[model samples]
Target: MSKTALITGASSGIGKELAIIHAQQGGNLVLVARRADKLNELKQTLESQHKVSVYVIAKDLTNANAPQEVYDEVQTQGITVDYLINNAGFGGRGKFHERSIEDDLAMINLNIVALTLLTKLFLPDFVKRNSGKILNTSSTASFMPGPLQAVYFATKTYVTFLSNAIAEELYDTNVTVTNLMPGATESEFAKTSGMEKQVYLNKQQRHIQ
Candidate 1:
């Protein structure tokens, strides 16, 4: 049987590319994103090209109930997940105190809370089967203290550290966890974080090649 991958934020950016890569490899997909249209479009494209099954969950990961909902949905469909990608995250610009409390909370909910919840919910199944792969998307910003984007950076640090620690704990198990640390590449992240000018100019000056 083909392996299955569940990717959060699969509608765009890194998540979207990852899904495409998995599809090309003939892996079945469970794509989750807030945009149903985009998710459906990707499903069509992948199924037509790869001839692999594609499932979509259109819901906001920031929701407290989302993790369980995703798990239950997968169970109802009799899908066995061989991989999980926690790639759903967003950043907020400006000082901690200056940013909107709601936006900061949403970032925390998605980046930290939601990620942890889903990991915990899935770890048992992966452990029981003694096999699985997990990929969590962390950022280079996780390595430093982001002044303007304080909470956002802190959340990513949590994700990276958490993933590493769990990976160590599961060292003896067949499961493998990898935290992808990607430097600023092209994405909607800048606009979403309201840091377009800052990220763009820095990229242009550094010519990150």
Candidate 2:
């Protein structure tokens, strides 16, 4: 049987690509994102082309309750998720003290709290079945302190550490956790982070993995 994957941030960027790849492999999908229109569009396209079931959960994951609601919804649909891909995140480019506290907090809530909650909610089921895979979309910024994007870098550091630690914890089981650290790529991230005008963005080349 084809596996089912529940992927956050499936509206665009790396998340969208991951969803496409999974659909191409005949896997069912639970796509979660804030943009219903985009999610629906992707769902229609993927279902038509790949003949796989696609469910859309349009949600702002920064809300503390969103993770539980996603888990509950998945249960209601009786979808057994074999893969959990946490790819919903954003960064803000500014001095840490100069940025709005609310924005920084929202970043933390989505990047750290939401991801952790979703993992907590689904991991038990994976352990019960002795199978599952988790892919966390971190960033190359996790390796060093980001002067202009402090909170964003810190949150990703947590992601990388958390993913690696959990992978070791599940060493004896079939469950696996993988962390992907992608460098600058063609995405809305630069514009959303207010870094589009930065000199580094223009000069930096996309990292080839």
Candidate 3:
């Protein structure tokens, strides 16, 4: 049977790759991202190549109410998201104290706050029916403190712990939570996070969305 997956940050990077993988398996998709153009582009390619339905929701998840609005819109559209993949996040490389507070806050909003809200919004449906899955795009940075990217690491730590806790909570049910900590990739992340000029902290640099 073909399942319907709703993935955030589906415009690029791991999220986009995940969408492609799912489409290849004949699953329908509801892709959420700030870039409608990218989402539509992916939608067209996936629909043509895989013969699966693609729905695009363009909203900046950094906003406080975006998560709720997204949930409402999904409900209005009568889309049943069988899988929820929270994969949108960014990091800044610099001393925590030296970095701009606004930027750090935005990172928290996207990486931590937005992810949580989306999970909260969707997990209940999964629990109600004793099915569904959640895949959060955390990082290995969650495992320890990151000096240059302190805030980013902290947010990921929160995601890891949260996913674990929720997984345990749903042990009696069929609902499951999975956390992904990618090693490295070559993406627009380094350039956007202001890490391009810095010495590479880890070997096998990662691709970002």
Candidate 4:
């Protein structure tokens, strides 16, 4: 049977690509993002091309209650999610003190809080069934502290450790948690995360990998 994947940040870049790939594999998709128009456009394309059902949930996950809301909506639809892809995140460039507290907190809300809550909400179902997969988009930045992008780096580290611990916790079950640490990629991430203006991106060509 084809699986169903619920992916966040599915309107663009890595998230969009993941949705497409799942569709290509004949899997249904529940795509969540902030832009309704973009989500609808992607939904139309994926449904027409892959002949798979695609549900769109346009939500700004930074909101304190958004993760729970997403979970409730999914439950209402009666869609069994075989995969949960937490790919929604953005970074800001600046020294820690130089960055606004609000911005950094927002980063934490989405990168850490939202991801954690969604996992907590869905993991119970997976555990009950003894099946499911989770893919969280961490970053190589998690390996060390980032001088310019402080909060973003720290959040990814939290993701890495959290995912690792959960994987071990579910070792006996088929439910699995995976962390994806991607290096520099040419995507909207560069532009939104302020990495495009950083020196490293300017020094080398960023080809899609």
The numbered model that scores best in TM-score is 1
Once fitted onto the true fold, the runs of candidate 2 whose alpha carbons sit more than 4 angstroms away are: 199-201, 204-209
* Top lDDT hit: 2
Cα miss at 181, model 4 (Å)? 1.0
Off by over 4 Å in 4: 199-201, 204-209
Candidate 1 clash pair list = none
Give each model a TM-score. 0.96, 0.95, 0.94, 0.95
Tens digits of per-residue lDDT for model 2, 61-137: 99989999999999999999999999999999889889999999999999999999999999999999999999999
How well does model 2 score by local distance difference test? 0.94
Better of 3 and 4 by TM-score: 4
Better of 2 and 3 by lDDT: 2
Task: Name the lDDT value of residue 16 in candidate 1.
Answer: 97
Error of 3 at 46 (Å): 0.3
**Total clashing pairs for each candidate:** 0, 0, 7, 0
CA displacement after TM-score superposition, residue 189 of candidate 4 (Å):
1.1
Where model 1 places Cα greater than 4 Å from the true spot, the runs are 203-209
- lDDT for predicted candidate 1 compared with the true structure: 0.93
- lDDT measured at residue 155 in model 1 versus the true structure, 0 to 100: 95
Q: Is candidate 2 or candidate 4 better by lDDT?
A: 2
